[model samples]
Target: MTEPVRLTDIAELAKVSEATVSRVVNGKAGVAAATRQAVLAAMDQLGYDRPARSRQRNAGLIGLIIPELNNPIFPAFAQVIDRTLTLRGFTSVLCTQSPGAATEDELIEALTERGVDGIVFVSGLHADQTASRDRYTRLITRGLPVVFVNGYAPDVKAPFFSDDDAAAVQLAIAHLRELGHERIGLAVGPSRFVPSRRKAEEFRRLMAPVAGEAEVERLLVNSLYSVEGGHSAASFLLDEGCTAMVCGSDLMALGAIRGARKRGLSVPRDFSVIGYDDSPLIAFTDPPLTTIQQQVSSIAAAAVRALLDEIAGLPVPSTEYLFQPELIVRGSTAACPSS
Candidate 1:
């Protein structure tokens, strides 16, 4: 007894190409698990027979490795990278690194073992000039198309995308200077990272003349990119008699505000704080943080496009593509207390 079945029925049921269904039904390869499931669902809905021994496709998966998903900034970037990859007909495998967990090298090796088409790294070891570059060179030797985001190693042969940290600090300093914040302070991450070094250098240059020698020393504080780091850095700034603070991240800025309140100080009154990376939900925080907004979509899209272009044998620009951040004025920052 022959059952009633047609390609159109299978295609409509699976919501996929008749070719995909045919590939699955004929025990062929190159179909994704999720896609294969969709086809199977469609067949079941249409009461079609099951395939004998269908397997999933492993060819189109791309690896996206990022550092520390706890920060909103990293997650925001990851989301964009994932969406952009999916739109390009590639399945994304997001690998996030945490303390004592999977290391970047291990993640890369695993992804490669799984036969990823390419790799995208965000805020990885490339940002640290002190870190070894042999891993990157080895990947290059292995003929893998790797793209870097928010980290640029000049010697590494790959397309890179990042925010202009110097310009970001300059923008923040300019705004504070305009507001008559003569005794301004800075709270940023460690200087080992390229972005932090650029920010610190630009800050010193800008503060050298505008602020006095004692004030300049008081104005700079290095710490982690967290709320607690911000709290401690702001405490130092306050102890040094700083009236305003410029932080490296929105999370740090929030911490600065907390530090001030702990001492019975009011933001924009007793202390003014500015933050970087105007990530999602930052505006909804108490007093609404004034921050520098990273061009996430543009940067993410550019990185993916560069990697895909390289994968397709197209010429990718070897230079770093730096996107400038915009300063968003919000309630967290205001006129200096003297004004």
Candidate 2:
């Protein structure tokens, strides 16, 4: 048998009075939804079982489809989105795609069959220039409420939330330039994805004035958004005599560091590196990374809000919303060695 829940213990943990805890525990209607959630959370944290009547009935199910969880950035986004949905009384059904796992279409089909109230896509095929947008069109045609994150399709009628990829690249380049590094390179993902394309284009436009068109082309390297990809791209850039590089993701940055070390070079002493998506635990890496921080919390909250509005039959403009990213300077960068 489960131990009884002590009212005083819950009140103190939840920062509410005994009466409030009692009301929440007994399933009274007076407590605010957020407060009730808080009480329930406190009970869970304290290892106390909730009263059967106090359990909340989920308002509806929301499908969240993301590329993969291997990348820390995706998990970070998932946590925020899931928490926000829970607070709003909705249960989030997360569908993740991997090399041999179910495809996006398969996941969407399963979600639709389950009668989800809405859906959110993160870095999905909508971001791939080569992928067809007809799948999204069919969903919209069926009156399904959907939202896209980190991708934009001009013809797709949905609200999109994305980081300012162009701005991110510009910021990284400007910072390296200010450090007197003229031989800067860009290591990004495949050009087919929207974010990679934006970053690469901005890199070319900004570096053209400094490195000329021909040299700028040599400075840009397209690879996978993985550590191995970063390592390969960095090897090529290092051979091109690039003293600094701006990577598409923090994982790539870590790989670049490994590659530079393999070439008998010291980071920030012989070469400098900057990364994007300042993912969790990146700051704890040896010589904590200097990276661009995507506004994950803000972006996730905005995406959830827009999705809820659509589900509520509110008029939501089908336009892309770009959130600004911040540059987090750390130990991974310094004045160009020759400077």
TM-score of each: 0.83, 0.96
lDDT of 1 at 119: 94
How does model 1 fare in lDDT? 0.87
lDDT of 1 by residue, 89-145 (tens): 688999998889998899999999999989999999899889999888899889999
- Candidate achieving the largest TM-score: 2
After superposition on all CA atoms, how large is the RMSD of candidate 2? 1.7
Clashes of each: 2, 0
In the range 1-339, model 2's lDDT, one tens digit per residue, is 967768898999999999999898888888887788789889998888787888677899999999889999999999999989988889999999888999999999999999999999999999999999999999999999999999899899899999999999988998999999999999999999999999999999999999999999999999999999889999999999999999999999999999999999999899899999999999999779999999999999999999999999999999999999999999889899998
lDDT of 2 at 183: 95
